[model samples]
Target: MNWQRYYKFFNYLNIAEADYFATPEKATQAISTYNRALRMLKNNKDQTEAIKLIQTIADDYPMFPEPSHIYGIHLAEQGEYKEALEYLKRVSLLDITDEMANMLQEQFVVIERELKAERSSARTQTQKTKETPQNKKASLGSVLQKAPKHHNKESLSKSEINAINKKLGNEDPSDLSEEIARENRVSDRRFLISVFVVAVLVISIFYFVIRPAVVNRLDGGQTVNQLQWLENEITDRAKDDPEINKLLNDYLSEFSDESDK
Candidate 1:
């Protein structure tokens, strides 16, 4: 829907301007346009136009409930009630599936029987135009009355304030001022707890793990150095004779094996 895109842009404009209601009137207009187009296309019987609009709407908004509902409505008028029922089943118009869709199915049944009755009673049933739109309010007036007031509270009605207050749990206006403060307090507490956990983990690793491992490596290195010094002393003493040199080699080999273990 072009109206849908325009409505999204309206939201962006409100956010960008920081007005929050920058395009409130325009947004209402867009919604009215979208709804009007949906209703018109639902009733319009021109098949080519109907097909093109329905396809466009469905292509643009596959997830919406209206496009498929209208397709079913058109199919129903064209005597494809079963297929119509399939598509109509997807929508919740007037809670149609509960009692609404059945209204359509019942109508179809009555029409089918009426066609039989027409054959028997030939000129019996009378049809006439029906009045709709009971208790209708002016569109502009309704929009103005129902739209939220982002303006000052002095301009807000008791009903408007009450509606707004319900969403905020009937709290004082002063509490509304502190809404962001509440969120900040929660975030600060959560951040502090997370920092404390991380610091504890780091400190535990340094004290219980890294420090002990460093001490063990230093002790093992000293033992290796002492073993090497003992081997050098034995070698110097054995350098005077060949037999002693062979014995010294075998003894040092045994010491090397023991040190490695």
Candidate 2:
């Protein structure tokens, strides 16, 4: 009466001795007895056992119609319509009884229709998502973000201009362009003023500090040379006249004594 236990015992025996189920008649008889016991079960354990037993039979005898038909219906009950459809379609092609084949064919058609509807609904939702302006805008942003690094300065400027235009919405681009131009002009003027101030400082240092020191050194050298030439001329004239020489010597000695003091 415990069909699940009965199926499990036979399943284990068959595994231990593959020759036990070597004959088609023996396999068919075991499957039929298992199905009868499964119908008697009325508990949760029975439901679980039924699923396992049916799946095992389907796998063991892939060409068997009864097991495949039941397994397909079980899968359909579990909301696995696509998988159920495949098994049921296989059963229909296995040359089973006309009544059983017709039943499986009906189930297959219903599952196929449901799958088609689900696919259609999904496609419609996808199309709507693609057509949305928000999605389109996001896609545009993605493309711009993915732009290559080879872009030139002019392209960058144009992109900036376009971004500004978008941000301003209905405002004039010319006004913004003019404003930027004015700011640039101010920056240029500040730069020029800085250069001019530095140049003036350099010129002032050269004239007042460097130039004065150089001129003083040149004048000192010229004066020393002229004094030496005058002293030489006086010595020559003194040698020719004794009185003049004495007078000149006395004056020179006095000058030297004064200079020493």
Candidate 3:
């Protein structure tokens, strides 16, 4: 069985099975399986099984939009926004309905906003924590600088001497500062790792999954609507991430030349 036909039907275009598939019986069977998965998803008792079934379908039929869409929604509802966004972005490569497209766009906006807010809050808290020790050190230094250098020991009140000793006995400000800096470094490392993982995932999906489908479509001399959608998505995303713009633009230029022919 030529699975590419099924891939094109579910990914590139939403055409009738009779017109799109060489074997209508196989297509019908796939659709039946998809429906069964959907029904399982609707049943609260079968949710875990439903997700496994959907994931199996997705793996078997790479780039099939419906399973990705369902899984994306499920992930979002579970508060796993980053993974949800990735799955939804995959769905955008397919010929999904306008409703699905709209939902994808909304999810993108929400996830981006959530991530931005989280980063902002973390930075603010870190900054405040880092400043606190510095401010205390500065205040202590100012007090020492203004103190009389030659004051007679007996001239100091007992309360004043006790206060000075109490301040000195507290945890060392330098030690606290060092700990905060260490924590910041660890946080920075973790953030960089997260970014690297996400980047690798995006690159892998583009190279291993989407790239093959695109080459297959081009070889078949099919419409370039899906490619156009991808170009537009990249264009919009490039506004926020300039790093990937040049690579994607270069590829799109090649696609444009081929489509023109």
Model 2 Cα displacement at 118 (Å)?
12
Q: Which has the better lDDT: candidate 2, or candidate 3?
A: 3
Candidate numbers, best TM-score first, in rank order: 2, 3, 1
Q: What global local distance difference test value does model 1 have?
A: 0.57
TM-scores of the candidates are 0.28, 0.43, 0.41
RMSD (Cα, Å) for all candidates, in order, is 32.2, 12.7, 51.2
TM-score of 2: 0.43
Give candidate 3's TM-score. Answer: 0.41
Model 3 bad stretches (over 4 Å): 1-30, 132-261
- lDDT of all the models against the reference? 0.57, 0.69, 0.71
State the lDDT of candidate 1 residue by residue for 196-238, as single tens digits: 9999999999999999999899999999899789878768877
Give the Å error, residue 178, model 2: 6.7
